[model samples]
Target: MLIVGLTGGIGTGKSTVSKVLRDAGFPVVDADVVAREVVEPGTHTLEKIKLTFGPDIIKNGALDRHKLGDIVFSNNTELARLNAIMQPVINSAMVDKIAFWRAQKVPVLIIDVPLLFERGYENNDYIDKVVVVTTSPQVQLERVKARDNLDETKAQNRINSQMPLADKIARADYLLDNNGDISFLEEQIKNLMTELKGIAPKYGTK
Candidate 1:
């Protein structure tokens, strides 16, 4: 099966495109969802996180993600430490999901990973292509503030935490520009689905 890696910076509506692709009948595995799943309460990963970051990060039951985020987002070394614990677990689970989709005879599988490029998922053997969603940085900041209700400084901090959109664009095999209206974005996805279907059948058929 064809594995397509979908990535974009924060507030670029990557999830919106993912939803559209899912609605179009593609099995989309969201890495962020998988990341959270791996760290669910009582999981080995969660235990490792508590051991590494401290027990205080866990709330009454679940991991206090905001607390963990506050620590990691400010320190690159801390973020790397957390990634070291979670990345492999998430990747393995994601690969299993991909295999499950392929067994069901899905033609094209979409892996919507926010850090597809950062984690080298795009270069992995499974991913056949990479699609990077993009828009103006100003639009991104505004959307993020509006969506998450963050002030300018906090929004910028979140945006700066990821690899820049321009760098991702340079690596994209396909680009979905979400600058215009929702209808325009939808149109791009429809066209992309048509194109991908043409190529995807080859893997599923034989």
Candidate 2:
């Protein structure tokens, strides 16, 4: 399996691009999905979180994502603490899924990870390339604020919490511009997937 790692800062339309790839019939392992999975109601990961961060972050026996986000979004230290707790469990689950697919003889796979660069997936043999979706800082700020129903300050804090978009772009094997309209993004994705098909013909069939 040829694993293509996808990442982008908050509000950069990485999820949308991931959908396009899946729509094109490629297998995609979404890290965000596994992050939620690892911390579900009865999991040891969630138990650890409750023990470490206190029980308040849980509501109705489930992780209160919003409550936790409110706690960590503004404080870099708290965010790091949360990442340290969650990342390993999430990565382990993701690795298992990738292994399952590879054993099934999947021709290529897409691993959508928002923190691909930060967590150092660059060193992973499975990831053949890294794609970063990006747009202007102002646009990102506005989009994040609108999408998350956050004020400018809170939204900016969330954006600042991630590795900078510029740094991600610099490290990218493929950089995509999400600074334009959806049609433009769709066109760009189509062209990019066409190129990908050439590189990995077995999985590129659409």
- Candidate 2 lDDT tens digits, 39-78: 8889999998999889898999999988899889988888
Worst 10 residues of 1 by lDDT: 197-206
lDDT of 2: 0.88
Clashing pairs in 1: none
Q: In model 1, how large is the Cα lDDT of residue 156?
A: 85
Q: What lDDT would each prediction earn against the true structure?
A: 0.91, 0.88
Report the C-alpha lDDT of model 1 over 62-158, residue by residue, as the tens digit. 9998888778877788989999999999989998998888888878899999988889887788898899999999999999899988889878887
* lDDT value, residue 114 of candidate 1: 95
Q: Look at candidate 2 and tell me the lDDT of residue 98.
A: 92
Error of 1 at 114 (Å): 0.3
What TM-score would you give candidate 2 relative to the actual structure? 0.95
The TM-score between candidate 1 and the true structure equals 0.95
